[model samples]
Target: MSEPTNLPVDPEPIREILKNHQQQIRLGLRMCAHCGLCADSCFLYRANDRAPEYMPSYKFLNSIGVLFKKKGKVGKPAVEEMGALVFENCVLCTRCYCPFGIDIPALITLGRRACRSQGVFRAYDK
Candidate 1:
């Protein structure tokens, strides 16, 4: 079998998209409860036998919650870390909304938007 090819990941466009939708994203993040309902709804969680990190709320917590707890006073490194979790792991697929009846992908997208506004997303290679 051939080896799997790794595709290039460009964070710039994701950042730009997020930047354009920051307010909506911020509002969505503010409404989450980390209730784990979204986790139950995640395919990743099901496939992985319920790893907490795969849960949508946990992922959101890792991104938005960290920023909120720090009140955006975090350093660049921390921001970058959170951005990776938000942008890389999340597909903005809206799958996690089933359990909680909440729009989690929207929330995640909003968080990404915030990251984009701060120039925290990865730069695309020309």
Candidate 2:
């Protein structure tokens, strides 16, 4: 197999989009309290022995939430971390539930899109 490489990213367009699309993103991001109730919704989290980073909230919070908070000025390391969430951690199956009504699946999906737009993706996501 080929080696995994960090995704090449350009933050300018991402920053502009985050600035323009602050409507629902802000509310959606803040809705979660990282309560961990959404853990069961993901097979990866369940099968992985409930690892903290595998939880849906972690993916949502770290990916889109971080981007929103930083106004998309995230460095390469942050983008790589988001890739972990989007690629290896989350498959965007869209089958998620949140007791706190946070809609975790949608948030993760948004994160996936943002990462995709910035060319931050693994060729074969686990």
Candidate 3:
């Protein structure tokens, strides 16, 4: 029920969060073979007719992956876009399967944190 903020992105906290989890994020991003093996494990993917964008790895790549790639220097619009991917698109069901055991939910959670750091999040009506 909270409203999204228009405040600009702050590099310090965002970088700090990324820095704390840099190793994990880097490994997840780099080790992802993009082979689509994890697709079947995602309910979103299966329920959405196996769309590529709904795949667990795809979500990670687009959300947290982008954050790491940009070194947490993304703008408000980028953060808002990530808000959709991480908060709206993902329910954090934690059912995603990865052959490499990439901990997809944790990565998505990181994405949520990154978005919140920029004052972007899901808004609900009361």
Candidate 4:
């Protein structure tokens, strides 16, 4: 397996990329009701003993939510951290259900895109 490499952080392009998806991010962020109903549907959450961080809403809130809130001005380290949350933590399972009809997988995908712009992504062994 190759080691994960860090690319130099450039805030301008990251801002631009995120700007393009502003609408979806904003809608996803606003759609979550925070009722915690989706938690039980996640295998990771249940396998991990119901940790709050494993919950879909919690993951979205902490990663995508934080990225949008900061307006993509965060550094590489922050991006990497959020990458772990969205990329490593989530598999875009699409099994996570929101009674309010929120699209959790799409939002997580948005978070993945944000992380990719910063060169923070999952490293697979060849």
Note the residue pairs that clash in candidate 4. Answer: none
lDDT of residue 101 for candidate 1: 50
TM-score of each: 0.61, 0.83, 0.90, 0.87
Least accurate stretch of 10 residues (summed lDDT) in model 2?
Answer: 1-10
Cα lDDT, all candidates: 0.61, 0.76, 0.85, 0.79
Q: What ranking of all candidate models by TM-score puts the best one first? A: 3, 4, 2, 1
Q: Candidate 1 lDDT (Cα, whole model)?
A: 0.61
lDDT of 1 by residue, 68-110 (tens): 5555555556556667767666667776774435567766665
Q: Local error of candidate 4 at 64, Å?
A: 1.8
Name the candidate, 2 or 4, with the larger TM-score value: 4
Candidate that would win on TM-score: 3
Query: How many times do residue backbones clash in model 1?
Result: 2
Candidate 2 stretches with Cα past 4 Å from truth are 1-9
> lDDT per residue, candidate 4, 10-64, as tens digits?
7776677668878877887888778999999888889888988789998887777
Runs of candidate 4 with Cα error greater than 4 angstroms are: 1-8
* Candidates 2 and 3, the one with greater TM-score: 3
| Candidate 2 residue lDDT tens string, 1-126 | 113446556777777667766776787776777677888988999989989898988988888888989878877667777877877887778777887677777777677777777766667534
